[model samples]
Target: MSRKLSGILNSMHEKNMDALIAVKPENIRYLTGFNPSSFSLLLLKDEPVLFTSKLDIEDASQSSKVPVEELKSLKDIKELLKGKIGIESSMTVETYKKLSNNFKANITDLIEVSRMVKSPDEIKNIKKALEIAEKSFEDVEFSGTENEAAAKLEYNMMVRGSSKPSFETIVASGERSSLPHGTPQVTEIESPVVIDWGAVYNGYASDTTRTIIETDKQEEIFNIVLEANKKAVSAIKPGVKTSEIDKAARDVIEEYGYGEGYIHSTGHGVGLEIHEMPSLSQKDNTTLEKGMIVTIEPGIYLEGEFGVRVEDMVQITNRGNVLNKLSHKLTF
Candidate 1:
């Protein structure tokens, strides 16, 4: 077995876990190197194995580093469990109940915790994904409706070799931009448009957000958001709490009396999945560590008016290093 796989098995043994049941697609891909299209499971132990449907068998066989087996049903999985099993906390309650009847199941985030720190190879994939996303944005013509702009940008990413968009492309314009998670609509482009987009490359993901401002008020909010993003990035370092990084950015907006407008967490870890552990939010206490890549996005939303957000991918080394190369200021 590879040293990394053996290390994970050793860790599981230390925790008194006979097996780790990974249901999250990202976790499955992280351990096995196979991306599943339908439901799949990974049982991690001394001899790690992957269970996938018939449709994914060919892909899994070609990509998976470990042994791959055809999955018939949950009943088949239940029979495979021998002793105490570790399950991810993100597993749905319904699935948990269904799977917990026979085995000693305990909720664990062992895989996610390990994923917080990126390997050198993982970082390279993330950088490539970011490069594709940034280049695609530069090629897009921002002179159309929100939906058209989003569609064009996504097409560019795909043509440039991204398997797909990391998430539903956000292209909120004008007042709609104020909604932090606003989805693209058929509305015409306006004074300010918040474009939050990402792309998937070789199973890794990159997330970034940029706002194009065309009004004085929009510029004001943009500056505040930018300042917050900068402060947050500056605060990232080994051993610092994730919440502290969040406050470093949030305090800036709050000091400007726009605290209430900042509705979401400052950022989150990105890897095989766009969103992962070590969340930079008030509720998360994960400590910063080397080789971790996360986003530093802060925003200010004015109700029924407009909003601005500046986001960039940050690599936590001995200090924070911004991975985005594009200039923050963009105007139309």
Candidate 2:
């Protein structure tokens, strides 16, 4: 907690922000160690305080590292705000309007920027999450409708100790697999089933996707996507720009003359949120750094047909160390 608080304080100092107002639940948990059920706020000054509602006061008092107080309204919170307030970009307009009277709001992502690089404990939780997710998937029976398959996978994750799936499990199969973020339907599971799933352990998340191929054409595209995934993972190293990693995978697909069939960025950071900073894409220029947990997912989406995606989590150290032990190619 001290390390996290100090990092944010130092960053706020550089920005000349007197304090940072953290309203996002994830940000609040990162700082205070208290996950709020109702509305809450963290005033990040030298002497930080967590202001939570009456419903959460008991929990916050017991769990929060910093002092916890009862908040009546935004007016009450405003009285505590000091010079040149720092706010997150995610703050809603209605809330911003209420807090924008006297203070000159500096739209900043101080906490998020700090969160981009994970700590030792955060890494541990992520590894545990991955373990749970992978273990749950190893025994799942993919012999039902897409929606049933999704439900079974989710139930398996919960029984294995995941608080919940990190996000909606992607169980796109057959032609529906062509949709990158497709929702599971009541139809029967088909060949080239794409299962994108995750598990949350102690707030950190593990995300992975694997496609089942049974036809020669599906195998062809699967090999291409697998090549792209492996090449992208191999190219990840400290000091390399994230865009370069995306290009490494994208180049493979483009060279195969299926560049147009490949959609979405190569990957993104995964921790508190499934999608976070340092996006691996053509535009993101953030350099790879140690202690960063990210996903490398490369896919080929063929319209009017099935699609294939292979994804895995990686921790950036001296080089990319793959966290997933599951094989890329899956039978049935």
Candidate 3:
């Protein structure tokens, strides 16, 4: 894991970056073991340093893999700044203005690119997160309002040591499921409830969606979605283009005359963030590689009707190793 620091530094050297400033929490956590409780910065060069505000200094000192110091002020940071400074593209404009005056600040995705591949520890954390989410889901009762079910599942995850839900707990039921990013509601649970949620453990995440169906029409859609999900997962392998995997799922749905219903990308890389690099979409051209973790979630949503989605996390290797063993079909 310490080699990640060296690898990124070598990348900076090749780019002629005199130094790099990192503020994005995930990137900071990737480089340093500690996730910041407040504002923090990572100064990258030959000898990297982690700077955290007074509020986070104690915790940062205890876990930060790199040297930790108090981030006194922006001006103090300026004093240490050098030429051709590289910064994350996700940096806030206000902070960019603070340090832009003295350095040749350039927006770069160096850290994100490096993080696309997972190390063994990262994969382990993601697996633990998946275990928490799946176990919580297994105990969810089909009876109740959408909000209540979501609340129960999340509380169960917390008891299992997941610090929080990686994303909003989605329990979109009935017609509301047609909305790809539907929020849970207080309304009564109905047939065909689409529950999409994840849990976070050790700062890594696991995302999965299981739609409970009762009607014949809903079952039809779910089977088609299941086929797409299976084919896509089967297609994941090192050296294959990410888009090809998406196409594999999309083609299956399109052949079934439901292409338009499959609204979103087939999947996306998962790690510190639910959505990251190497998106499994027709537009993304990144080649799949070993050690990358991603989700295969293909759904068919019919407007004014319910939606059916089947999602599972897969780790890229010689072949896709699906991390979720939960059955795709959920019933009362």
Q: Candidate 1 residues 1-84, lDDT tens each? A: 765577678889898999989989988888888889998988888888899999999999999999999988878788788788
**Full-model lDDT for every candidate:** 0.91, 0.92, 0.92
- Arrange candidates, best TM-score first: 2, 3, 1
Order the candidate numbers by lDDT, best to worst: 3, 2, 1
Instruction: Give the alpha carbon lDDT tens digit for every residue of 136-186 in model 2.
Output: 888788878999989988998899889999999999999999999999999
How many steric overlaps does candidate 2 have? Answer: 0
TM-score of each: 0.97, 0.98, 0.98
RMSD of each: 1.3, 0.9, 1.1
Best by TM-score: 2
lDDT of 3 at 2: 90
**Per-residue lDDT for 283 in model 2?**
96
Q: Which residue segments of model 1 deviate by more than 4 Å?
A: none
